[model samples]
Target: MKTNLVANCHKAITNYIHHTPVLSSSLINDIVGAELFFKCENFQRAGSYKIRGATNAILNLSEEQKSKGVVTHSSGNFAQALSLAAKSIGIRAYIVMPTSAPQVKMEAVKQYEGDIILCEPTLEAREKTAQDIVDKTGATFIHPSNNTNVIIGQGTAAFELLNKHANLDAIFCPVGGGGLIAGTCLAVNSHQNGCLVYGAEPFEADDAYRSLISGKIETNDTTNTIADGLKTQLGDKNFPIIKEHVSSIIRVTEEDIIEAMQLVWERMKIIIEPSSAVTVAATIKSKLLVKGKKVGIVISGGNVDLAKLPF
Candidate 1:
């Protein structure tokens, strides 16, 4: 919730990121029973807000630091973002991703010209493989959420959202590793807009919710939910930021997530991943409420493989 971090992130990532659009849908507002604004990061470059964080992390690097290239581990979106960003700046990118990452994401990373290292589908394995890659290649390790620059960079979304919709009373974002919510907390609550920032997590893997209630960071004993994108444990850095500035974490289920994904695709005409659908699901499931007040929900990514989607 540092003001300086938000300011620095704004300054650092301004040239690199999009001021992703915020649109109000009477259709969504009617369905959700709230006056709603959608911060459509699903429409963002790299298909996600991950680009904001990834680009910030890469562009902040010193010439000497970037000389060895950059390495990161992701379920999908971050890998694609880093791949695209690194390629743009003429830096090499090595991405360690779970084998279970959506085929679409894996293909996108390869399409963006990243060197992909596949590991078993778990954060632990992904981290280990990423470390091994870094050790051998001398590439700098860029954590998806734990990195400060990355967190700050991710906050730029809220900065843009608030600039566009200053009156929003609340904002809901999907929580994976907690980077997006952490940055949002800093940008929205810790700063001038003072919106109530809530995080949505899969009930199947509701680490952030438990961590918030328990007053400590918690990892799910076993990951679940179709939101394969939200499986990472909340970060140490992000936990503190959420505890400080975020209002609450809302939990939803795989059923809820799939329903939400279908809603977005069918009604909103956006192809959202289940992870991104968490926010919409939380809003609809009455796990959280916005009522007559203005509400903002971030669509985190749209990289779901339709062939893999559950109808």
Candidate 2:
């Protein structure tokens, strides 16, 4: 993807999306021995950066496509994101969520007026269900992470971050379906300052890390990580960008994720989901990599079940 794609996307969605703040904590900075800038997308619309891409994708759709509406299979942030984005534009949103998804997540989509189709808790089921909706209703299928407009939208978060802190030595983000990190890679390329992009993933669900090493897409043997959002593997659309531009993928243990989440909550007094915490955990785990540098961490989301928090 070109840098202009991300730059233009940020400009296009500026009015529609929140310009989330970059927060810092001196205590946490001291612990990591680096000046850490947290791009707090946890405070973003739909409670995650997913809304930026979701909004961009829908806004770019043709009038005919908008008339038929849109459909996607996501049980997490993207479901709510597409629902809210489509709702904002007065279009119908069909969200296919897995039966095993948390009831709270399903309720959140319903709150946004998304018509939910229940399917078995498998990627195959989710894809087939979403396709069935597209076949029946002619709704455009917007992939959560692989769509080009969506990647450009996701890049806007880091684009805004780099615009505000162009001097950052490197930026780290949690990797899942790879949209955000791939977008981040594109955003970093726009700056002449040579800011590098890194992805933080859980050891339990480290397909991204393994994929980088194997030089092809890799799947997780088990989706057993506490960072539920990072369980998905990379896609053809984003994986190429990741392979070319991302500096590396850092793997952190489950204990590291929990400790990092607790640290952010206690020190920064912010509620970050485990996926967001992976970036911080990676920074802490690889302290020497960022020592004495100005580093940016993308806090991806804050939507967590309060009753089942890891801590």
Candidate 3:
């Protein structure tokens, strides 16, 4: 995976990905008790780091394949990403989203002029609908998390992080479908073996944590997390890489997420959704106890609906 990923798609995903800066913050660093280097991927185009994977997946396709168009199932961000990329390339895109996905995200897909299909919130239903669309249209399916190309493209985030700060002691990212963390672990393990990789999840959606501990895939019963973007089961492609390189999993509460969101908005002046805030939440509440570590955290996305906030 490393050889195939690093050697091949890294260059392909460059300019399209923001390479969002890693800034040192006294507020975050002081509160967390570490030199907190925040990789502000919240600044990524398409409101997330997903643009890299979407671009990579599209570019890897043959002209005939692209001519046939692309389709995928996503909770939201990937849908918006692929929609934007597909529009840019003059290719058709179909995005199947769960009915429960954030309305704002669905609107973004529509704004990109994507054909949106709503499915029941279950993974099986979403995938089935996506496959049906693919079969009906001859469009290639781009798995949101499981594909080698997508994972490698995601790895570029951690790759950019390390390129900026080589001597970091650890990297933290919120986990969901595991594309971001799995790719991040691969990049960090190959480039910074000394740095620990941590996956942060809301307690309500802590499937990755349980899955890692039990040495098998696990699902959470309480899928009622506000972190809507971190709401998918782990995929086969992401599982082995996680089991291999992930240092540990940390769980944060809903309160922690809210506080973290407030922290970014008040101190960092950044608007992050609940899912992206999980990295900040776990960093401050769960893993901040790791004193003296130089920790780098990827703020995955910043596409929050601020008008809904009571603030």
lDDT (10s digit) by residue, model 2, range 118-219: 999888999999999999999999999999889889999999999999899999999999999998988888765888899999999999999999999999
Question: Candidate 3: misplaced stretches above 4 Å?
Answer: 1-4, 99-102, 286-289
| 1-311: candidate 1 lDDT, tens digit per residue | 37777777788777766777776768878777788788888888888999888888898899987999999988668888999889888899999987787777788999989999889976679889998988898899999888887888888888787877888888888988989999898888545765798889988899888988899888888886788778878878788888887787788878888888888788877787788888998887653367677888888878767566699
Q: Which prediction has more favorable lDDT, 1 or 3?
A: 3
lDDT of 3 at 139: 98
Screening candidate 2 with a backbone cut-off below 3 angstroms (N, C-alpha, C), the clashing residue pairs are none
Candidate 2 local lDDT, residue 126: 92
How much does candidate 1 score in TM-score? 0.93
lDDT of each prediction vs. the true structure? 0.83, 0.93, 0.85
Q: After superposition, which runs of candidate 1 have C-alpha atoms over 4 Å from their true positions?
A: 120-124
Evaluated at residue 190, the lDDT of candidate 3 is: 75
Number of the top candidate by TM-score?
2
Candidate 1 global lDDT: 0.83
lDDT of 2: 0.93
- The 10-residue segment of model 1 with minimum total lDDT is 284-293
What ordering of candidates by TM-score runs from best to worst? Answer: 2, 3, 1
36-127 in candidate 3: lDDT tens per residue?
A: 88888788888898888888899999999999999998867899999988887789999998889788888899998889889998868987
- Model 2: residue 291 alpha-carbon error in angstroms: 0.9
